[model samples]
Target: MIKIYSITVTTILLAVVSLISCSSEETSEKKQENLSTSPATANYAITPVDLRYVKLTDDFWLPVVKRVQEETIPYAIKKCEEEGRLHNFLIASGEMEGSVKGKMPFDDTDVYKIIEGASMTLISAPNPELEKELDRIITIIGKGQEDDGYLTTWRTINPKKPPAPWVNVVEGKRWESLTASHELYNAGHLYEAAYAHYKATGKTNFLNIAYKNADLIVKTFGDNEGQIAAVPGHQIIETGLIKLYALSGKEEYLKMARYFLDNRGRSEHHKLNDSYLSAAYSQDHLPVIEQDEVLGHAVRAMYMYAAMTDIAVLMKDADYENAVDKLWQNMVEKKIYLTGGLGARHEGEAFGDNYEL
Candidate 1:
């Protein structure tokens, strides 16, 4: 029972807007926003995905895989795999933790679970060396973990755990928690990664480890009263856990995820505790899909809905999927930008309407 006290008083309002008008040509008044550095864009066209057989990968799975494996996970895995390395690699090896040229040093134990997950994508990616990195990455998670199955590089190093401390930390350079708390997102990612890895190689070790960690998360967060409401900052875990439930015949995972989804934006859990912290994170502040106009964080919103869709499918909940379908319709038909980027403004790093980006 995670309760976000911050946003309980601030009600989230929902309204349905008409979908974007159909048009053939790009708006003529467009300014050339320099996207030379953007990831290579494919035509944004996609056939309607039938999840029954094709196995609905996350909509952003491919781009996320490309970024995580080639860019983020390799460097992180290298540091994590090194002999007796203490910092989060999900740490950079031989790279200065305090310098400019090194990899982003995120040496927290809770965070590495994400690196493990990001590395997990190699199991599904097109690259062979990436596929090879999965086992080595898991080994790093195994080595760095505490005996209680607690593994977060940050917490491991900074032993004095603060309640919701992650939500408030701001570095001189950037939002530390944006990426750090993202580990939960990473954990969800890892869960997906482990499932993909295990299926790719017929090895249950990866998923088995995920089940262990997820059980811990579920146990601790299961039904505590004075905590945050709302959902995970990253949404993929819901889908990941749902997939796990579908495969393992486990109702517990689905139940826990349902708890996460149901409490989101509701006043039920947050009225007692640190609810205002909800302002620091947005997914906690609104009902899924009811926020028709995408607000708050971008990555968090999409992943959350993606997970919502997954659960809706598994339980055959038309209401949830209808919400997902509405939002999906909005994004595909109205909100998405030209390069397939969801959020246009980097400030909130969130979605803008079609042609608005």
Candidate 2:
């Protein structure tokens, strides 16, 4: 699976935020006292600085940012439009006729990711032209969304037929093949990108799409009656939901995120029938707090750790924090590659036994 390196991005974001403001010793002591009395009220240990407050003025990073603005963003947009990714969105909206037109089940995410990157660029330097282009993409994305808020172009285009042959076609119903369907994964990316756009532009156009889909998710899954009792085959949805919660301060979003995290490794929650995607492969063999070492797909493991860190700080959960601390130590001291790439071995694209790299 392709990983987005979210942990690295989040860490860098937090570091910049720290540089913008430094708390006094007395303020830190007061916060510590509050944590002891009411941890939930305590602020996140590290916070991401709003992009508006950051200006990329350094020589090295400034040119790189400018290149992405002048070259990379337009290039990626042109390629996506030329390659029929934009066409697929229209097809899903019934504006055109055909099956999905991509090799990967989650190909639509390429568009969403482009929008996210461009939106971030707009944050550092306001560009009306790029903002308009993003609006146009978001309009097409709105067309692709189902009335009920479903947005995966492939599955939305044709439920009975998947873009890739390996996807088990189970009556073409949504969520049937959690391990390969990638419906939830696509939604996760949409939510993430949409949130970024909202933060950058302060426009609700993209965010409304995210809100509708999130509401559907909140209604569809939980411990409540009539809700599905399963976790994502992929891990990033948990963090995506948490990001929404952080943005909107909605309890339902936070609860849904917690539901996904709390259910992992529990027998009653979702599990894959395939041996290859078995619990261990997805980091579902043991509860998050019980696992001390990383042992799954490298990106997925890091994404999950990122969520655990979010929960640890946002919710002030000690067990989750302790677990993440131990896991971080193991990765740094034992399994990490000399090149600094995660995943010590190629098999299963996961970590190997200690020092195996």
Candidate 3:
């Protein structure tokens, strides 16, 4: 049995705070001083207090946070390098050789996520050494990116031979199979990590990489003549783009985010037929606004819900808000495990029959 972590609600709460804090106009003037950038002026439903304003002095959450900063962050970085997570980036950049060295197509995200976590730690506690280490990782990531801003190491290294045989390799081209390729999923993590780095250190290196890639995403996908009207097989990119929009005040990023969410489950959008690519597995069985049940990969559902909540408040769309509320009730009332562990079934890392846990 998969040992699931009991942090689903906590993750959503943190994401909600991160997203809502920026768009909230009611953030007090005193809180604004601690923010890396001025609190966004966009109208939102809940204005979360800035992390800098909220200190975790309590014995419970404080040590947990510090352990991540003091112990987990260092250990993870070492393992990533030792295990070739960092070297894949180097190999993709021609700094090394041989085939991809990871089990998953999206292992690059491990590095990005680690940096994101460390950056978040820096936000609460100033750590120059940790910040510098993150800079080193981001620099390597930038080197691995393709000229047009694509950054998936496996595809870039050998698209014809994906790390996993299950990934459909079509002419070794980028964006060929959005459903299983996980290209967008990697970018979503990159954007999240880069934005965190920016917030933590005021550095633009990683953020610029994200911006370039995001711009390409906006350029590549849309309802226009040449674009692909497709949604991600996995979610989280929508919320990531939304966060970028909140930070940069760029309407296009917000539009692309909304586009991804709106296009899900529509015949007009791309579809997949693989065993795991089914609509329900990826939360694409229905339009997000019409989705009531939190079906699919549990983490994907959480990310989508976070984005939906953001849309509800940012766009003031009552329908989206209502949909999210219904989904929340469904999870809390029926699906959630007693230990707060979600995704009870490890088969697809997905939700199970109501109250199966």
Task: Give the top-scoring candidate (lDDT).
Answer: 3
Q: What C-alpha lDDT, on a 0 to 100 scale, does residue 107 get in candidate 1?
A: 33
Q: What is the lDDT for 284 in model 3?
A: 81
Worst 10 residues of 1 by lDDT: 9-18
Q: Compared with the true structure, what per-residue lDDT tens digits does model 3 show for residues 292-357? A: 898888988888888777777667778887888888888888999777788879888889988788
Q: After superposition, how far is residue 265 of candidate 1 from its true place, in Å?
A: 0.6
Comparison by lDDT, 2 against 3, better one: 3
List of clashing residue pairs for candidate 2:
none
Best by TM-score: 2
Taken over the whole model, the C-alpha lDDT of each candidate is 0.50, 0.77, 0.78
Q: Which segments of model 3 are wrong by more than 4 Å?
A: 1-28, 32-41, 55-67
Query: What TM-score would you give candidate 2 relative to the actual structure?
Result: 0.87
After best superposition, candidate 1 residue 296: deviation in angstroms?
2.5
Which of 1 and 3 is ahead in lDDT? Answer: 3
Backbone clashes, candidate 1:
32
TM-score preference between candidates 2 and 3, better one: 2
Per-residue lDDT of 347 in model 2: 77
